[model samples]
Target chain A: MSELEIAGCSKYYKKNGEPMCALAETDLHVKNGRFVSIIGPSGCGKSTLFNIIAGLIRPSGGHVLLDGKDITQESGHVGYMLQKDLLLPWRSILDNVIIGLEIRGVSKKQARERALPMLKNYGLGGFEYDHPDALSGGMRQRAGLIRTLLYDKDVILLDEPFGALDAQTRMQMQNWLLDIWKDFKKTVLFVTHDIDEAIYLSDEIHVFTHRPGRIKATIEVDLPRPRSEKTLMNDRFLTLKKELLLMLREEQVSSN
Target chain B: MSDQLKDNEPFIEDPSVRTTKLRRRAFVGQVLVGVIILFLWEFLTRLGWLDSYYWSSPSTIVRTGWKAITQGTLLQDLAYTSGSTILGFVSGTAAGYILGLSFWWSELYSRIFEPYMIAFNAIPKLALAPVLVIMFGIGFDSKVVLAFLMTIIVAAIAACSGVQSVDRDLEKMLVSLGAKRRHVFMKVVVPTTIPWIVSILKINISLALAGTIVGEFISSRQGIGRMILYAGQVLNIDLVWVGVVALSLLSIVMYLGTVWLEHVLMKGRAPKS
Candidate 1:
């Protein structure tokens, strides 16, 4: 069964008394425990789609379903991580991580207990008590990821989580994310403009067209498991990269 | 080993050490300047370059202050003024913050009241002293009401901006994570507003004090303001100087107290060295 399904979902905004379509009618289905990614140009409605999926905003039409139940216009069902780390500066790392649990009415002590081992596992062990400002950019993103995971949602939406990291850190985070996703087996919808990142991490890649976005293509990533830095040099990886790059280049040119 | 030690010495001038050295120099400079000015004042008065009766030397002010202290009037007046200022500050800040939060929560309400709030803030609060004195009859409550009028507008504006400027992405993240409205408020909104609230509290201390003194000036049987007014009437320049010094010391103490509270609350979040 699909963990999440968006059936004919669309969004439009009224601007200066004229309606502007942000997202065209779109349909998506993510099988349980699979990783999916969406890639598009800058002005594309990728974020709008994510916002609707996360239930932060309502779709102009159609329905969103989780396990066959309509959940359109309802929030707090999925975990979301934005491009920015968004860690509360006032909170220590441990406190920030447990915010989701706290919102669910878990006791602080209990939330701390649940969050400690995850922090230690995520390479933020000793730094749990440190403020967000003390962390490196990559570490701050790690803290944000942990906070999202602690929410324990079945479907997680990652909107370019490594978009701001240095190249080396971004590669490292991609590997770390795969490791965690493999272990947890939670359904994931990742969004990025990086073709290499999408190819490296996703089981399926959804390519989006520019504004009033619609699914341009859905390509299956048939790369073998236990993918790593070595996979970047693989013949298959190069071929897939070329294919995605050409598609995206065409889209960018046409949009202009 | 000696060469290595010498090389390490340059790197040893870390920010903390530099800050301490700079702070110590600043303290010395401040004290030196103060001493020089006081000495010049005394010398000029003694040499008849300035009228002692009008300008009262530092020694004479100190003597008057000591006499007031011994007579118990200084302590009593200090307590009265401090008490009113504290009461007014606490209540005004609390009310202002609550109102600001409500305004943020309801956009329509804020729109309706924005013009009125701005108008009230624009008028000098000291102008209301006579009215407050009339209504409260020159008691402690009158001074507190004046202080409240002086402080509430600033506190409300600060808090309202703080709430409005909280990161939109952070709020979205919280909402996506199954957080309720209350959770978003406690975790995102309140913590974001804290620094603004602390800063306003520090500013409101001086404003509250100013309001209280003005109220006292218009009509009050006690307080440092009254002390200064009485000394001025009798032409006792030393006593007036003593009252001014005491008020300055009181403001410094209150400001320092607010700074300490901010340090404690902010903890690791304080700006890096």
Candidate 2:
């Protein structure tokens, strides 16, 4: 029911008064309740495609369909999270977490009632009334993830959501994300530059080439469920990582 | 540990307590300086080193102020100054804040008015006091208008900068949550800019008071400024000092009141760190 499709999407920019292609025509599909990741180099149009998919930018040519309905240039069909967690500084954690519901016209009391359990369950129980600055980096990210979930949309777009976290915290957050993803049964489209992170968290990873970016390969990660640090040591995990590294290396070397 | 403690025994004050002690000493030193200056001025006048006619002694000034307070309509004058200041401050700030934030609604409107706002900010508003007095008349309306003029541009500029510096990510997050334009302004734009607006409040109050006093000075029959102007014209030096002291005290009280207002607005809203 929550499938997302990006059909023939492309983006162009004018540089020095000359039209330049940033993202070539690309198509992407995420079936119901699947975890998909987009990985590419720094200058590639991954973010351009990401913004187009989020409907934050209008593509030069393409259509984004959600659940078989055309939603191109129409935002609010999915929840979006960025690298920096944008919790309002003045709002208490409880209030910040419930902002999605608040914006969607839910009564404050009812939003609070619904958010209370999630906050308590997600290691944020005692900090319900504290401001955003009171929380550590990882805790704030958790709060942001909860906010995204509570938006009540089945499709969630996480653009380097854990990119800013330290290594240890990033691993823990990935496990936490997987647990939540399983429990909620939501479709997630994750964008990141880290191959290890993409392999660990995603069911499928789409690799993009440099500049005028388009998908170069779509690899399905076939690993055991309830994965742990041991999974990273597995031969399959190592093999997939090598394959992704080689693909990305080609782009990086070519651009250089 | 014992050796370390002994090494540090020359200065055992805790950090926070040391700061408090230093602040108390600063306050005491300020009061001592004021008292010493006032005593010297009064003593020099009485000893004829300074002429009593030209340089009024503190005691004479106090006596003149007491006489004015009990017998003259000094309270009414105080009330008049206070009224115009308050009316101008509230009206100007509210109107300017709303106008500045409204710039978010349309790019065209913001672009057109931004240069005009900068131009207005560059002009010395007090120079327009006489003209404002002429248009609004030499009554309460004139004083109120001058005060309003003094505060409006500053508040508008502050609010405009606040709106401009609003985090794009916050706005994007809100939009993604299905928030309308007005909702983003109200929830994200306004709250994020509150600190900026409040940071200007202290400056605005002082400017508003200056505007009211200048209006009073120009052509008013009432207010402390009027009393001071009239006393100076008539060479009533002691009365002039009385008016000066009264105005100083009045402004200090109003400044404290503004501080309290800022506290109320920013309570629990400041960043925890």
Candidate 3:
């Protein structure tokens, strides 16, 4: 059984007396411990789809099940990261990491003990008590990832986690993320508008069409694990990027 | 002492240290200006340039304050005023925070109470102090009630806006993190409004003191306000100045104490970035 299953999910919104659709009969299933990427243009409801899977928003018409059980009503089970690295500035790096644990009713002492290993493993050992403002943007994002991963959840939803980083820092983060994922083996659903990122990180790519977003295509990335920016220079990565770009262009024309 | 070999050297300052030093220097400059103004007043009075009958010299005021202190009347009056001010401040702040939280929770409560609150606030509370004294008598209760009336209005307004002004993204983030309505209130809403509430409390401290002093002047047989009234009636300008200076000092001390308390409580708690 899959770790997450979204069957026939749809969402809609009304704007200025005009009916606008965000998702339409979208069905997706993620096997346990798989890295899946959802790629599309802006306003494609990719984030909306992730919200549905994470149970942040209820589907207008469908069911979201986890491991053969309906979890549509349950929240806090999935770890989510947004575009902005929303680290509480008042909280130290260690405190930020342990916030999810604290929220889930893990005792503070126990949470700190559990969090220490993760912090040390991620190279944030000596900076446990240092607040978020003291850290650089790249360091902040790394701490955010540690925050989500330390929650000990089997599924994680990353919404443009590295979208705020510079090009050099973003490349560094991609390598770091792949290493973390390789070790954790958790089910991952990453949303991004960057085609290069989609091709680089994903085991499989789901291309989304324009508004009232529907799946355009599902392309499996046949690349090896622990890929780098050098992989982007290779023919396979370029070909996958080309295919995704073409699909997005056709969707853009139709939506226009 | 011999082991501590001291070399005279200029201090190497951090950037933030230099900034702090600059701020302290500015504060000292303001204090020097205040001292200069006081010295001018004293000089004018001593030289007979200003009328000594109405405006007493600073030394005369200080002497009057010393006489009041020796007789223990100053301490007695201070106790009466401080007691009323403290009681009224605590009651008003508690009422304000509760009402503000209620307003945040229920739109219906806000609609019904908000307009009435505004109407009541607009009526000069000082004008009502006489009527309040008439109703509650010349004891501490009337003074406290007057002070409470003065403070709660502003505190409630500040708290209501603070609660309303919380960042929407923070609320959404908390909600999406599986926090229920009550949890969101406890975790996100409360922390965000604390700095605002503290600032409001600082503002209300002076208002609360004013309310107490006004009540004292109109009805109380004792207190700094009554002392001022008697001194003015007898044309003892020095005693009047003493009472004014005492009140000013009390207000400054209270404000600074509250600020220090805020620092202690809000340490590592504020979300400023």
Q: Each model's fnat?
A: 0.79, 0.62, 0.25
Candidate 1 chain B weakest ten by summed lDDT = B2-11
Q: Per-residue CA lDDT of candidate 2, range A1-53, in tens?
A: 78999999999999999999999999999998999999999767887877887
Model 3 clash tally, residue pairs: 0
Residue A203 of model 3 has an lDDT of: 92
lDDT of 1: 0.90
Most accurate candidate by DockQ = 1
Predicted candidate 3 versus true structure: per-residue lDDT over A76-134, tens digit per residue: 77777887777776677888788777777789899999999988887687888898888
User: What DockQ do the predictions score, one after another?
Assistant: 0.68, 0.65, 0.45
TM-score for model 1? 0.95
lDDT of 2 at B195: 86
lDDT of 1 by residue, B185-237 (tens): 88888878878888788889999999999999999999999999998998888
Colliding pairs, model 1? A76-B178
Kindly report which residue pairs in candidate 2 clash with one another: none
Which regions of candidate 2 deviate over 4 angstroms?
B1-27, B48-51, B271-273
Better of 1 and 3 by DockQ: 1
Each model's lDDT comes to 0.90, 0.90, 0.84
Candidate 3's C-alpha runs over 4 A off are B1-31, B107-112, B269-272
Clashes of each: 1, 0, 0
Candidate 2 has an interface RMSD (Å) of 1.5
TM-score of each: 0.95, 0.94, 0.92
